[model samples]
Target chain A: MIAFGILAIVALIGGIGVIVARQPVHSALFLIVNIVALAIFYIILSAEFLAAAQVIVYAGAIMVLFLFVVTLLTAGKDDEEAGEELSGQRITAGVLAILAGGGLAVVGVLYPSQRIQLGLPQNFGNLRGMGDVLWGPDFVYLAAVALMLLTAAVGIMVLNRPPRKKADPEARLKERES
Target chain B: MMLLQVVLLVIKIVLLIAILMGGFAYTMLLERRLLGFFQLRLGPNRVGPGGFLQPIADGLKMVLKEDLMPDGADRFVYRLAPVIALFTALSVDAVIPFGAAIHIFGLTVYLDIANPSIGLLIAFAFSSLGVYGLVLGGWASQNKYSLLGGIRASAQIISYELAMGLAVMGVIMTTGTANLYKIVLYQQHHGWLWLPQIGAFIIYFITGIAETNRTPFDLPEAESELVAGYHTEYSGMRFASYYIAEYINMITVSGIAVTLFFGGWLGPWLPPIIWFFIKVAIFLFVFIWIRATLPRFRYDRLMNFGWKFLLPAALIYFLGTAVFVSGVL
Candidate 1:
């Protein structure tokens, strides 16, 4: 319990540190740090898979994309300037930000278990145990989920990566030649 | 156990975030060093001890840098895209576990955030949202190139992410759980999935690179072609945020490879944490090595690879492994 309290404190500190940091990159860096720590916290609660997925997917791939875009161009440190009034868009953005905050707040309030709890290792960090519990009786549900995953894998690939990059001239020529 | 769990989770978030942001700073240094090494030129050596303070200097420069918005741009979405991209990227860390728990003061500290059994799915969900950043950023920029870049990126990420998911599905089907830690443990019990699942891992790695817009798959930011891609109009620290986010994402993908294929933190002769880092580092090096070695695939070839080559192969591998595993089990 004492350790979780400390982790919560650290996450809060890191959260605040992100905004307080002078450099935009530093802020992003702080945010990334805060996230990784949060994943570790998830693990302490026996959510072992969550922690690994968090680090593996979130902390790893997405951030790399962000950096790739950021550095491919001019990266300066002067992003702290306030935006101009520029009509009601500013108000809209503020409203949207507030709405997001409100949503998080609502979720937080509703999910009290998500809050600081006493030793919360509902199960040990073992997938085999989870499988035994979740799939032992729920094999049908497991198969359903697997099917869903298969569909998601296929759907996203097809609908998104359409073969249109060469609809212009060269592709047509190659097609005709072939 | 439940009482102490919450307490321990709180501590882990703090440390993990600190480590990630800290690592982000250092990763900048590492990339610069590697870039200079590749270019056969000395990089920044003026900052703290061997340019180690370079990130610090860069940080100082960012706050002092200018923030500009182009005229006739969608002000709201433009700014919002970077924030969303950054947030989504950072959020993935919510699922990764670093080490075993230590029991102290009746509180056993967990080493991750949400150990959701479906954490692997959650990670992909966040990544799906990440493309919105590029799409929004490009659309908001109100420029043709930026818009095109955004279009390409959205298409690019959505495509590659699918292949990546299919590739990962191979692992989940074989291991029989979407839980990443279990996947790692599964590797430990069985041999490294990489040995048998080499095809899935390759496709996953390639798709991940494309998803992250790394070189040989970086048409979104193709300097000669797309200007600066989605952020052609961004300047100063807002721009810096994108840069930092990319390197961090690089680390993220590398971490995935470490976890999914390299038996994260399960190597002999080292503690789990050390093993995890070593594995992640090797993959990180691969990222740069690929950059230095391969030429960017033409846009059509990239799409073909995803659709013709990757998709079918991933599907076959996934189903084949599932049947094989189900029969064996």
Candidate 2:
């Protein structure tokens, strides 16, 4: 219980820091901390596979990508002032966040009797259990996810391809030679 | 009883940390001496007893030297980066079983720190987190070379990590467990998985080299290209943290290789701990040998090899092992 409380505090602070941090790199770091805290929550719940997957997939791969892009673009510099030209954007985001928080609080208050039990089964979140769900009835969903990722990769490749010109093949060859 | 257990746990952790620190120090001395031999030069022989005490001397030097931070650097993150690196490097050892549980004073003491159900994944996860140190250090230095080095390290790590993870999946499929000790036990019963999973072993070793940022994949700290790479501005003990982290990571990878493929602590006519150390030493020697022999890979070529070759090969090997294990092949 103490562990849970500590992780909760960490997660909450990380979430707030993600928005409050000045540098993009710091924000990404905060996001990583939040993800890691959530992973610890999974571990505390005995969802060991989920916890590991969360770290490997989310905090490891995805967050590395996030850090790469952030560093590439910003170089850890806070170039733009907070809420300078995005005053309305900030207000809209604030209002949406408040609405979501309130809605979740209301639902929790209304459904107090509908709270799920915390105890999980013997192999509830192990790899075998996850594989059964992913490869059994939900195989189509898995395939769909793979297909979607493949399509996105292809789309990015296409978008990134250099433009081709019909004229001056000899000139192009000479340019390359030079 | 609970207090006793807690005390045992603390003792185990302290012992492990002490052993690991000593191991890291010696491993550095060994590498330097070996590299000197490879290059036909005497390496740090002026230190006590044929440079046996060189690491101690090096540590003293590092501690006494000035710690410098660039004027424009982010002071906080600059300090935090090496801490993160070293922490992740050391923490991965929590899941690695050095030997089987032994009877001591009527209590069965497990050799490892933690034996989590998802041990292999935990190791990989912590290793993957090591990139943050390089990236943060480079970026926080506020130098162009550092930034480039950091970005390169991050990219290389990400690419190689996919291959490494997939390669390990092949072994996990055969063992039917992610627990390191269980994997070792399975190897003992079914013979070494490396015989059948040779491809995965090769891929794992290659990626392990890339993951640890050693030559020929040491582009992150490629001295000729980027001046000290991501650690360009670092000095003294702060720099030593990153250095120690790298060596510890090399040791961790060697431990993983031993656990996953070579049958951890399963040898004839020797104590389990001795067997484990022997295997790890062999792997460490191989790492240094490769560093001595191979020229560094070009940045683009390294990326290509990781993504184009290693990733696909690892994936196919993983799928093949999975299919075979499931009796679908």
Candidate 3:
């Protein structure tokens, strides 16, 4: 429980740091912290598989790419430039955030207590359990997600495909003359 | 009882770190000596018998050297990078069982630190995280070479990691487990996996070399091109940390290879722990041998080899393994 509290505090600080950090690279690092903390939270809940996946996919793979792009694009850039190009945007965002928070609070109070479960099955998040869930009755949902990812991958390949070279007109004319 | 368990855990961690660090030192000496032999040279034979004390000398020299931080560097991350590198490198060993459990003083002690159900995945996760150190170190150095090195390291690691993961999936499928100890036990009953999964083992070894940023794929720190790569701006102990991390990462990769494909710690007559070390040493020798034999890959060719050749081969091998394991063909 104490560990959980500490992790919660760390995650909160990381969330704040992502927004407060001036540099893009620093923001990415903070996001890693946040993701890692959540991964540990999954471990605390006995979801070792999820925890590992969380770290591997989120903190390890995705964040490395995030940092890569940020460094490439924003390296050595200063963050002090501020133009009031979108005046009152911050105020509107803050107002919407407050309203959303209030709405969530109201929902929390009004929602039936029965919706929340107090106990979990043993090894409920282990590989065996996860495999059963993913490959058994919920296999259709898993297939759908896999297909979506495949589509995205094919799209990337298409976008990166090089333009086909056109035959040279002068070469053709020279060959015809010969 | 809880106190006793905690004490045991702490003892295990200390011992593990001590052994791994010591292994790192000697692995460096071993590489130097082997490389020298391969290149027809004497190789550091002055200190102690056959240069056995060379690693100690190297450690002292590293500690005594002046630590330098490049001007205009990011102070915080520059300091943080090596720590991240070494930490992740060492943490991967926690789940690798060194041998069968031993009975001592009315208590049973497991040879490994932690044997979580997702031990294999944990190793993958920590290794993936290892890239942060190189990338951050390069980016923080305020050197174009370092930044480029970091970028190359990330791209190379990410590309090869997919092939490595797919290759290991063959072993996991055959054994039906991710726990290292259990995998070894399965091997004891079913024989070593290398013969059955030879194709995957070959692919795994190749990708493992790339993942560790070793020769033929050591483009990240290709000194000829990048001026020592990501740690170009690092000096003294910080540089030593990166060095130590790389060697230890080599050991971790070899250790995993042993556990997965070579029937870890299973040998006739010899003790299990000794068997584990012997297998690991063999893998380490191959690593150095490859380093001495192959020239570093050109950048574009390295990426092409990883993405085009290794990835497809791993996928095909994995599919075959799955079919066999499931008895579908």
The C-alpha lDDT values of all candidates are 0.76, 0.92, 0.92
Q: List model 3 lDDT by residue over A84-146, tens digit each.
A: 798899899999999999999999899846666777886677888888888999999999999
Candidate 1 TM-score, true structure as reference: 0.67
Q: Give the C-alpha interface root-mean-square deviation per candidate.
A: 9.3, 1.2, 1.1
Which sections of candidate 1 miss by over 4 Å?
A1-178, B1-7
Give candidate 2's error at residue B295 in angstroms: 1.1
- What's the C-alpha lDDT at position B170 in model 1? 79
Ranking by lDDT: 3, 2, 1
Clashing pairs in 3: none
Per-residue alpha-carbon lDDT of candidate 1 for residues A1-178, written as tens digits (9 for 90 to 100): 8879988888887799887865444455566668778987976776766565665566555654554454333232245565665879868988999999999999878987655655644465455656575677988898999999999989998998956666679878998899
| Tens-place lDDT digits, model 2, residues B1-329 | 89999999899899888988999999999999999999999988988899988999899999999999998898889999999999999999989999989998998888998998789999988988999999999999999899999999999999999999899989888988999999999988999878899999999999999999999999999999998899999999989999999999999999999999999999999999999999999999999999999999998899889999999999998888888999986
Which structure is stronger by DockQ: 1 or 3? 3
Candidate 2 structure quality by residue, lDDT tens digits, A27-97: 99999999999999988878889889999999999999999988898884554665666458878988999
Backbone collision count in every prediction? 75, 0, 0
Give the CAPRI rating of model 1.
Answer: incorrect
Worst 10 residues of 2 chain A by lDDT: A78-87
The CA lDDT at A6 in model 3 is 100
